[model samples]
Target chain A: MKNLQIFCVIGSLFVLTACRKRLDSFLFNNDNSIIEYKLDSYGGELALDIPIDYLVPNNDIHLFEYQIEDEGEDLNISAIFVGDLNKISSDTVILYCHGNKDHMDHYWPRQKLLSHLGEQGRFGVLMFDYPGYGLSEGEPTEQNMYESTNGAMKWLKNNGLSDDRLVIYGYSLGSAPATKSVGDQSFVLSPSKLILEAPFASSSVMVQDASILNMPASYFVNTKIENAEQIKKCEVPFYWLHGINDDFLSIESHGRTVYKNHSESWKQKNEVPGANHSDVPTFMGLEVYSDSILSFITK
Target chain B: MVLVVGISACGPAKFVEPLKKFENAIAIDVGGPMVTIPDVASMPIPFSSITYGHGWSDKLTLHGSWYTTAAIFGVAQIGAGATYGVWKSKRQKHGISAMLGFNTAFDVYEKNFKFWPQLDAHYYFKYNYKGEQQEDLLTKNGRKRSNLLYVGVGTWYELEGVKAHGEKQQDIVVPMLNIGHDLNWKKWTLKTEVKLIAPFSSNENIVLDYVSLTGDKGSTGVYLGLIRKF
Candidate 1:
């Protein structure tokens, strides 16, 4: 019995170490580093691609960094803008918030695909790496995600893009910042429309789904990214896209609930057949996916 | 005590048959519902519990358990229960037993608490070795050898009236149907069980893909237990 008590104490301490920082850590898969933004030359496991004709000129891509204050720490966030920087004032810009995977390089192909939404370079695309992802400094946290995305928005606002032309797009983990920006009004500029692809309902929903019980999200993680409730406060037109076969985030629970809770505006949802979480854009056929976005934003 | 309510029940069935009066036992159990890992195969969530049981009478046994996995996750979950033998027939080698239990969990970080009430009833058939086989199976301590097969239905009742997002709680009672086998050895019993947990609840919307025999409802849970008698 004495040995058992000692084992319990030691085991509890060891497991407790593994239990903390769940939300901040689990949501971000940003540990891998890239020497450069290789784009098509990345030669990684990316399934999505940008055709040669649609690819932007070398000069059209601008790689830069900006600073942001994240809960008392200064973080340098890396970003890339594809399209003529001078055209920001006249052209509609899609502020693409990438998923919680590796750095900006991993999602460059998707953003490049978005750059050809209606026509080649028809819309300027801005993509950024949240702190702790890619070359950005500091660690990944929910606050850092919001602030890093906000820094990108502020940069666009300063460089002549207006809210009327600013469209925000989030995929998977990126949905937290995109939804919170529009819902909470915490960012420098409001987007004309909001797009979320494979967004989870909330952290609570994740745990509840895992345990098959109404377990509190706080018990497992401290992330309060409740896109379902946040969507209620968003008055802008909401565009939701999810894969019917998304195994990472369920379309029925995560995406559908967020869609159902968008009570304030003209909302549209596209459930692409046979698409999984990361493969939605590729599976939907880039042409069809682009057409859908073009119609939603143009409307 | 926090927002979400009535999340779980005690681990496995405490007793399928009443222990002899004054017998004490300790058991360790491991298992949980199976979930699919996207492109990966479906597997059970590993949950573990340790239990101690005492026989108060020939027909009744009391038991308590500490959820080791929940503790590892920083939730202090504990459960207590009593099993009462409702009917038995030595000649028929079959018996019925009922269990009433409760499980409570506390989040050590947030200091939040939750409680769930549970009930289970099972019918068990005992098969004893005959003649030479029975003599060969008998231990030096004169312990009898037998194998037991059981089928049971269990429920865990959630007390909270509403869900976490203030949605109406449609599933107040979670039901499970279980089938198991117990192999009684000299000083230890091995228990293996398969359960259909929350068969009435829809398994579709949730993030994890559950292994369910019932098309789109509920999930399958598997448990293994080792009990030592003293």
Candidate 2:
């Protein structure tokens, strides 16, 4: 019995040491600045310019830097709005949530493709860096993710965008906040529609899928991004687009499961063949992907 | 504590059996398994194991153990082994053992099944106290009481089937140090063990999609259990 007591004390110490905030699995990079590129003088050569102007031609790109209070600390958040700012009041805006990766610079091309969806410049696109990604401050966590997303939504709402005209598109890791925003019920207004691209089912499922082992995420991580359960409470039109060949989040286990769990009457799923986790837009071709998104929103 | 950690790896609690020879005895034990996370402290999950042993002769014993835990996930494992006594002295004994086992685990959310086969080889030493050196360490009531310490080196091999990544099987080889203490009184015995398992050989980084399982190289674990002998 005395030996057991000693063992318990030793075990408690191990618990204290092992139980810290585990964030590396979620956030990949800590670099703050966006990558810069210069265009060639020749017109035929396309170059990615700094401040991302070359990506969206004819559209005015407005950069907004804001701060939100999280856990009593101020976090710096960066957002990019494409198309005319005045059009925000009258035109529908798509809130683009990108996947887990480096930062916003890596997603400029995807955002550009979204802006061209349904008639050139017909709809505006809003995208921002989550905390610890790109130029955003603070660590990436479930609570922080919600706070950052809500901050972005509030910013858009304050700047003439209304709930009826707002569309939420979550790609990969961004799907956590996107699905959560609708299911939370605390948000002032729900978006017009929700889009999930190659979205995973939940954090636990992701851990199991990643480790190829039957283990719960709660054992290692506290983040619970339960999209399947959260989507059941959402009533808005849901659009799920997944690469049939997606190796990261399989369509059968994640995307298709979320789509099936959503009881919303207005829901659609597009399984792009020959596309993997990262190259959905490229595989479907920008034109077809844009048109398909345009049709989903307009319908 | 140790049982739980062992379950996390889909294996039996690495408890060192008693070095002293026994004639026609059966024992059962239950305890926790613990595992160490680098930089972070060692964590113990709730796990338990039941073991049965039969002595064939003064120098040979056959044993089987089944372990499981459901604290964070479900894990089930069954193992069978043979222990052979190599040397014995007034206050010391040495033994060698080999075990073969299989385990299956599943998570609540992921709903994926993982199956694995494991093999283990160990060489162990036991040191008995002054009172334990007597031929009969039992009381007038036929109750036995003694303190025994064990130390060992072991090698474990496992082929784990991870169903999440298209049924990919990962090969894990862990060389470990095992230390334990056994206290017996009457028909009840309490056993505690601590094992330190070195990380896998490859740097491929076992990415299960959200977490890396093999990133932490040196893992420390503990197991504690109560056994009943009849």
Best by TM-score: 1
TM-score of 2: 0.60
User: A1-299 in candidate 1: lDDT tens per residue?
Assistant: 99999699657644753554333465666744676677767767553665667677888789999999988878888899999889998878999988877888788888888888888788899999998887898888888889999999999998999889999999988898899989998899989899999997888777676555666776666777899899989999999999998866889768988999999759999998999888887788889999999999899
Model 2 Cα RMSD, Å?
A: 11.1
In TM-score terms, candidate 1 sits at 0.86
Q: Cα lDDT for residue A79, model 1? A: 94
**Could you list the CA RMSD of all candidates, in the order they appear?**
4.4, 11.1
- Candidate 1: tens digits of C-alpha lDDT, residues B79-123: 889999999986648899999988887776777787888899999
Each prediction's DockQ against the real complex:
0.25, 0.07
Off by over 4 Å in 1: A1-24, A30-33, A47-52, A69-73, A271-285, B1-10, B36-42, B129-137, B141-144, B199-205, B212-217
Q: Report the number of clashing residue pairs per model.
A: 1, 18
